[model samples]
Target: MSEEEHQHPTSHYVKIWAILLVLLAVSVTGPMLEIQWVTLLTAFGIAGVKAYMVAVKFMHIDQTPRFVTYLVTTTLVFMLLFFAGTAPDVMKDHGTNWEKPAWIAAEAAYAAGEVSHEPEHH
Candidate 1:
């Protein structure tokens, strides 16, 4: 086999492992800092980096075909799009303080005791 096809050096893997360990430590200790936004951003940012490392190294996605890489990229893009599309609705307030229409009708009938077993003529 060609030298280019061979796996990366042991030192490279060790370096990646060390970096991942550091990222893990940061993520674990981030919340303890109590900085709120900084902690959350740091944790998520470190997690994304760790995930990318694992995908490239352990999963060997880096050595995969172009199509496989494109597929993964496309999937991530679609996931982001889905989240973005739903975010507005999720964050918006529709002002639904009033009772539901069906529930209101049912409550009115219940209060009037209109729910009888006898048939009602039009």
Candidate 2:
């Protein structure tokens, strides 16, 4: 193979550096925001953008066959869907229903023999 076959010119390096700068900016600004939801969304969005840049441009994903690329992309999409779909539920406040009133509930349970108050040795 000739040198031409292996050559990726300086422009490719420049593009990578440009993307790196954007990624760096995002990394720096992401944590400085005070609004919780906006900050969370911004950080995740920046991460997704940076990941796409790295996967496509640096990883040479465009050189792969269409089916292989589609398969990988689809798998990642499903993985993101799984995570995103669960974040709110996992972060939600399920409220006092899941929590005991401590005094009344514990005492009632103990009186009813529904619970044992004996201390277990660690």
Q: Which stretches of candidate 1 lie over 4 Å from their true place?
A: 1-4, 9-14, 91-122
Q: How does residue 19 of candidate 1 score in lDDT?
A: 92
Q: Which stretches of candidate 2 lie over 4 Å from their true place?
A: 1-7, 81-122
Q: Which numbered prediction scores highest in TM-score against the true structure?
A: 1
Q: Which pairs clash in model 1?
A: none
Question: Each prediction's TM-score against the native?
Answer: 0.63, 0.53
lDDT score, candidate 1, position 52: 92
lDDT of 2 by residue, 1-122 (tens): 56675556879968987977877687668667767776776688777787887787677675556887898889999999999998765654344465335666767878998888655521
Assess the local accuracy of residue 51 in candidate 1 as a C-alpha lDDT between 0 and 100: 90
lDDT per residue (tens digit) for residues 2-114 in model 1? 66775787888899999999888889898788798979877898889999999888778887878998998999999999999998655543435643566567667867987
